[model samples]
Target chain A: MDPVREVEGRAYPFGLKNVDTDIIIPAHWLKTISREGLGEGAFEALRKDENNVFDRPEFAGAPIIVAGDNFGCGSSREHAAWALLDMGVKAVIAPSFSDIFSGNAFKNGILTVALPQEAIDRLMEVAETDPISIDLENQTVTTPFQDRFTFEIDPFRKHCLMEGLDEVGLTLERDSAIAGYEARQTGEMPWYAKGTALSA
Target chain B: MASKPRTLYEKIWDAHLVERREDGTCLIYIDRHLVHEVTSPQAFEALRLSGRKVRRPELTLAVPDHNLPTTARLDEKGHRIPIADPQSAQQLAALESNAPEFGIRYFGATDIHQGIVHVVGPELGFSLPGATIVCGDSHTSCHGGIGALAFGIGTSEVEHVLASQTLLLTQSKTMEVRVEGELSPGVTPKDLILHIIGTIGTAGGTGHVIEYRGKVFEEMSIEGRLTVCNMSIEGGARAGLVAPDEKTFAYLKGREYAPKGEDWDRAVAYWKTLKTDEGASFDKSVVIDAATVEPTVTWGTSPEDTVSIGGEVPAPESFADPSKQKAAQASLNYMGLQPGQKMSDIEVQNVFIGSCTNSRIEDLRAAAEVLKGRSKAPGVKWAIVVPGSGLVKKQAEEEGLDKIFIEAGLEWREPGCSACLGMNPDKVPPEERCASTSNRNFVGRQGPGARTHLVSPAMAAAAAVTGKLTDVRELR
Candidate 1:
């Protein structure tokens, strides 16, 4: 979980709408136990086209994806986020996102920027030729063409993404409080605290 | 003056709030966490790498359902049938080893208690009223039917819950769907939910937790309630609940994980108060006449792309939005359907009657009732019935549902999420259309290039016998 203050690179100009988790990475590819090397299978169906934008040399190693409204609509598989990160997608700019997908992306240090559809259209146009830059500190996406668009993100999520603090890190911050709760739980609800009692 | 009345969602949500953060997010205590094979391996691996053990293994339960083959594990001589695919084998193996290592209850491939995570949790009484539950699968909302505040979480959140037993969540808006009046015979909960999803597109319930109410839901059986809540994800809702009632308590009373004796009375007293207060308001409210909802089926790639069995496919020109028209056209092309074609006239090559959505004992009975004396059509190549769990399978067998299915020429198989996503051996061939009782009619969802039409179990059974998406009422 490396800190990400900014993401500066050419973005894949695919603004496809209703692009589901199944399309991001097919179910067959989810069979693997490992999360690594998933980029090869990322967008496997769309990549079947010889002239697919993902295969385009210009957008290779792009750190951003400008997607359409309601992106990542189906499934709670975290592999969708993992696949994007594997393919170097550090941020996704869209009009809206599936809440589960947004949470997954934030947990993995990927920024999901929700902007107006007009802003997304402008960004899509800018992404065609110039590199796009995202400044988490300023909450704006800028293009080499001097186009700028602002976005809103929950402050807590923004802080976590910028500082690379995952849920594990946050939980550890409250270790003492958690321990105290567990001690009380063991005393009050012994049946719930005992692993043997629950397994039955 | 009276305080502001809160919706059922608000009441349950407020009860679970442990801490309110400065960022307007709150930490909610998670009473139960469900895990399956497909999404949890990486989460467990992350925990291993970080050298953190499960904080409360007692609260977490792991099961392998997505990757398990829907066939008997033991053969004639008690020899185990081999898992052909290495990937599926590895995932099940990972769960078998990981659960014990992590000290969580593991229902493995051979465990009779093993089934779809969503089905087994409620069947075994793990999901309870007024509890905050999370799982790594979207259909975790199925538990909310029993009045729990439940929704899906990602693998990362699964790990978070494993380490802390709490989740940081921004509160969700509340939606009320009140379906009044009586349902016509042959109109099941599956049809009702499909109608709701079709009325409110796939993204309609986005960011809202829906509480289903009114006379129709109150009269529904627990299984019916579960079926309705199971597809809440299909309607784009974060979760859907039907508040705890007598039917819910009756269903859970004797289950293994249910509280007993004095604890039972206390639990019931608490659950009795889980309903919405009188005159409580919601962020959004919609009412439907349950009697008006006919037997429904999806005609396109999305769950919202649905229509009544007696209706014609939607013409792209009918849509005002160009994007929706384009999407409808795309769906028509992929489904090999014409815009004006009647849904019942479109033939299907396969029929699947199982999934977390509609694979309970009652679901099996509904399909069996339709197929009792009927035979599958000659054009139908394959028809399969996979129960939600071993318990469901045993119940169906005891009721002679398996005999009915077999006599009707439909294959009765073991329990697991077979043919739902084609992770197992069962799959609809490419370019073929299937009438499936499973959720999700996405193109290539059952298999690559496969077309799926979502329908109720009875509708699927009718289709199996007719070779098309026929209305179950007509068949009855």
Candidate 2:
């Protein structure tokens, strides 16, 4: 993961609400073992339409998406996140986001900005013809038209996005603490460590 | 001095907390990690590239469900048949190799133990009361029915859990979805949850864990509770929990992985204390009258686009918000539905009576009961019943449910998540509508351009018989 401090570009002004992961990337595209080359399949269903905004020359390869409320609302397939990154979506600005999708996006260094619908309405307007800029460090989304809207994010996630921290590696540093907890659990609740040995 | 009365979620959260950071993020230990073919191949690849082994292989279980064909897997000579789709074959092959390489136990594609991860977990007692379970698939919330703190994770988090048993997390707020009153006959748990989701909308439980409370849930069978909890993701909750009770213990008593002898008694003692303390506070709450819930079905692409069997399709203009109105119009277009059309008047070409949501033995029995002495209507082109697992299929066979289904003109197929997401060969053809017992009604979930109307098992059977959506109550 790369440090993601700022994402500034023309945003795909797709304001469809409840855009689920299935729409982001369908199940057929999920068979690949690798994460690369998913850009071709990103929004494959919507992209089938010749006039879809994603395929429009102005929004092609845009690094941001301005969507309606409850964006990325179904399925836990991280392929949705990987597909977005593969297609160069660095930030998604929505009024709200589903919890799992938001977490997946944060993990992949994609910034998710939640602002009031009024701010989103303004962003959607500016996104039609102008570039939108998101600053993770300052927790703000700004437009070239001098419009600035602030957002909220977990402080830890912000730090992680800025630093490009490897979460698993960091947790491995606390290996001793985990081992200690396991030791305690073994004594207190020994049944947990008993593996599910199926009877023949 | 008395401690603060805590919710069941808080109690489980406290028990699993390993460390809390200054930023308010906590490292919580995952007790069980379930892996499947689709979301796990990439995670294993990442692990191999990073030269990291599974931190706790004993705690992990892998099975190939998604991308697996529910068709016959063996030849007459008892040789294994190859998967038709090359990409799917490779994905399944990767898990077959990765599990053994990482020292994790895997139920192979043809193993009697192999099935949907959610169904396999509780049936084998791999999921237990008060455990924290994580899986790459969203329906992992189904394990919460057994009183676990379970939620779905993405491939990145799947890799994280593989490399380390703990995950960096923030605590979720608690919500109580309390349902009172007795459920009317023929109103299944699937209908109850669909009605709940219709009331609360898809984003209703976002950022919170829901604890189902009151008499309705208490009387529901473990399978019924599992069906309700399975769609918690569709409702936007991270997980849904029902506190462990005597029924939960009874359901687990002699299962393969449940504690034994003295351990069983001790486990039960601990599980009994897993309930919410009286007067515990919830961040939010919603109450539903169970008797009011009807046999429900979805009318549009989204799960929230649901109505009772007797209700009419809502007009797009009926929505107050312009965005919603636009969405509703699009959904109606995709679903080929007209406003004011009765739900029962809509015809379906396909009927799928299986998924992690409703593929257990109980669900099969319910559908079989409806299909007995009946056959598929002439207009219904395809109808199939896929059990959740091999064991579930065996149990259904022993009970002669397969005969009932076959006699009624529905294909009694092998076990896998067939036609649910259409990763396999089973799929509802484009532009065709299906009455599905699966969780999601999202566009293309059953296949590209496939219109899915989510319904319960019995309701799906009813549709199969009538070749249209029919209220099960009216079938009698």
Off by over 4 Å in 2: A197-200
Write one digit per residue (lDDT tens) for candidate 2, span B1-476: 99999999999999999999999999999989999999998899989998998988988999899888888899999999999889999999999999999998999988999999999999999899999999999989999999999999999999999998889999999999999899998899999999999989899999999999999989999999999999998899989999999999999998888888888898899999999999899999999998899999999989998899999999999999898899999999999899999999999999999999999999999999999999999999999999999999999999999999999999988889999996999999999999999999888999988999999999999999999999998888
Which ranges of candidate 1 are over 4 A from the true structure?
A179-200, B1-3
Distance from true location, Cα of B61 in model 1, Å: 1.3
What TM-score goes with each of the models? 0.97, 0.99
Write the residue-wise lDDT of candidate 1 on B155-189 in tens digits. Answer: 88988898888888999988998898989988999
Considering only chain B, what TM-score does candidate 1 achieve? 0.98
True contacts kept of 2: 0.73
Error (Å) of candidate 1 at residue A1 is 0.9
TM-score (C-alpha, index-matched) for candidate 2: 0.99
After TM-score superposition, what is the CA distance of residue B396 in candidate 1 from its true location, in Å? 0.7
Error of 2 at B229 (Å): 0.4
Write one digit per residue (lDDT tens) for candidate 1, span A1-200: 78889999899988887788888988888888887778988999789889888999999899999988788888988899999999989999988888888889898888999898888888888888989999999998998878888888899888887777766767668777667666764564333343324433
- Chain A fold similarity by TM-score, each prediction: 0.90, 0.97
CAPRI verdict on model 1?
A: medium
Q: Residue A67's C-alpha lDDT in candidate 2?
A: 95
